[model samples]
Structure formats: structure tokens, C-alpha cells
Target: GGISRAGRDALGEATAKILASANTYENQTIFLTGSKAYTLKEITSFISKILGRDIPLRFVSLEEYINQYLNCLDEYWVRLWARTYLALKREELARVYPTLENLLGRKPKSLEQTIKEIFTDKQTGEKESKLTNKYWQASTFDNK
Candidate 1:
């Protein structure tokens, strides 16, 4: 308990120091990504406030086949994330899509749907390689 808090405080101080130094540098780019959308936004805003410039922090969903499959097996995790996607509790379907819910209807039901939702360019649109396909493709963080 104490150790975790200590590590957290140390991290906060280190982050502050980095922010201060980065402002002095004035041209370095910072990327933020995580499951905590709010935390990522906060960190990105903090850096922007320090730098007095707009930082391009993009959000990408974290989608992984093995991870999604494992999570689907966990009933509780499935319910929570499906609700996040507003999914209709389909045990038959392995993964859920928030984008599809946002579509209201006519949801795309394949790798094609997911890709169309991501890339806006109709001409150059293509599915991600099996190795790289995941829920979110924001420029902030890479999956393990």
C-alpha cells in the first residue's frame, strides 16, 4: 500500500519535471494512450497548458484478438465492455463495437466494418493486417 503510493508520488513529480523541461525545449512531441480515456485527455491537456501550444494527442481503441477472446470468457468483463459498446448481450458474438452502436443501424459486421469506421479515406481504405488489427488505432500507444 505504502509502496504503491510512494511510487505514484515519485511518478507525479517525475512527470512534472518532464513537462517543465519539455516546455523549455518547445518542439518535442508527446503521445498519450491508455484505457483511461479521461486520464489520457488530462495528461495531454496538462502538456498543452505547459507548452502553450496545441498537442496532437489522438485516442485509439485497444483491440487485440487474444485479449478480446480472453475477456469474452470473463462474464463480468464481457458485460462491462459490451455496455461500453452498448452491445445487445450476444454471447454468440465474440467481440463488441461501440462504433456499431453509434451507427444506430446498418452496422457493418466484419473486419470491413471496423476498417471503414477507422479510415475516412474511401479510396485508400484497407483492413489492417491480422497481426495489427485491434479495436483502437490511435497514434498514442501500441499494444503489447
Candidate 2:
């Protein structure tokens, strides 16, 4: 999976609810999660459908990942990410929790909605947004 994956908007709302009821939710630990956990393959497939462009993917081993990123990222970050990916592969953060929806009293923004927010203007439905362009530019893909 790409991440334990909760939309930022949904997470923010959940945080607000917890803060608002500080007395009730005091000293509590909640694992906020998306409606579902999406794998990287699924996310890229959705992105390709929306953007009408192929986004290539290449899998790498833990050592490969660390070496590939070490130049651009510090050793600390590279090692941290390596560990995180290992945990992800083990499905440590794969569980989806309803605590967010329960607190919000409505369905939280989904991963697809978050993708739309990043790539398109919701109100106008115009061309791809600047953020989308930046995303493409910043992204490093293995086309192999």
C-alpha cells in the first residue's frame, strides 16, 4: 500500500472533533484511516484514468529503495522510509478504522476525492490544476 491513507481533509475534521470534545476524548489514541486502503497500483490506475496519461511504476527491493533515494534524501529519511515500507508490506497499518466517520457523523472524503482535489478544480471542472502539473514534474518514475 502507498500509505495507511486518510484524506487530509477527513483527518483534519476528525482532529477538530476530538479537540472539541477534549474532555470526552482526553488521553485517547485514535487510529484515523480511510474508508479503504489503496495500493500504489490502484492509485496509479486511478490517476491514469483521470489524467489520460500513463504513469509508469517500478518495484524495488528495500536496499534498492534506500540507495535510489539516498542521494536526494538524507540517510536518516532514507532509512526511515525503508522501515516504513517494510512495515507497510507487513500490513501493519492496513486496517481501516471507522472512528473518523463515527466522529464526523458522515462519510469522510475518500482517496479518489482527494486525488480529484489535487488534480482538478471541483467547482469549475476545468483543465488540470497547477498542482497536477507540479506533481508530474516532481514525480520520479521508473519507466522500465
Candidate 3:
């Protein structure tokens, strides 16, 4: 349920081209996005791989996630967002858009590759941040 490699490449190329020819599309609103879409579960799996750890996942209704986890007034927006996300059909998200591919004359990268690129540093080959490591270490799951 994620973008293909061709889609990623197409998106990058399209961005570069748009920037180069800014004068042509200066006032126009362009809807540029990944040709393919991925579900939250797929995205989390990619993140787990990038972090080199197993990330436990559980599916729950919007009411469950909100009632069990969200407790503060400040977190109301998160509950709203989750409700909105859960409302969409999986089929709707799985549909691919060819606009990006047509514009760039190529396909985009796979979801896995894109996640790796985003999480790994280009020069050092290390993860972009140690936050995941810290969180895992500090979490009480192991103790349980």
C-alpha cells in the first residue's frame, strides 16, 4: 500500500523540473504527491525496519485508541485526526495516481527505499536520530 520505486523517482524528478521551470507554473496550484499510497500499518513496518527493531502494532477502533490513550485537552486534535484517518477506505488509499509519473517520465522509489533514505544519513550511514533507540531503552515493556 505504498509508493513504488518508480513513483519516488518520478516525484523527485518532478520537483526538480518544477523548480527549474518555476516561471511556467508560478501561479498554479500543483497537487504533487506520491503516486501510490500506504496504510499506517505499512508505514509503521517500514519505520520498524529503519530502526532495526520490532515494532509491535495493534489495530483498534478510533474510540478505543482515543479512550485508552488520549487523556488531555491538548490531545483532542490527535483524537480528531485519528477519527478522520479511520474513516477512509483502504481501497481508496491503494489507488495510484499517474500524474507524477507522467510529469517526470519515470516511476517513483519503493516505500522501503524511501523510508531508508529518510532515516539513514547519506554521509555516515547512521540513523538520522537516536530518538528511537532512546525510547526503546527507556520503555517499560522489557520489564513487563
Clashing residue pairs, backbone N/CA/C < 3 A, model 1: 60-138, 61-136, 63-134, 63-135
TM-score of each prediction:
0.21, 0.80, 0.59
Q: Tell me the whole-model lDDT of each prediction, alpha carbons only.
A: 0.35, 0.72, 0.60
Question: Candidate 2: where is the Cα deviation over 4 Å?
Answer: 1-4, 121-144
Q: How would you encode candidate 3's per-residue C-alpha lDDT over 90-124 as one tens digit per residue?
A: 34345566766667766556676877887787888
Candidate 1 residue lDDT tens string, 26-132: 78543211111223345445444433455565533345322544543875674355343222122222323232223223322333232233333345444332324
Clashing pairs in 2: none
- Please report, as a residue range, the 10-residue window in candidate 1 with the lowest summed lDDT: 1-10
lDDT of 2 by residue, 1-144 (tens): 445487787889889989888999878888898778877777777777778877766676667767887889999987875676666666776788889889888888778778877777778785476454644422223312
Q: Cα deviation in Å at residue 3, candidate 3?
A: 7.7
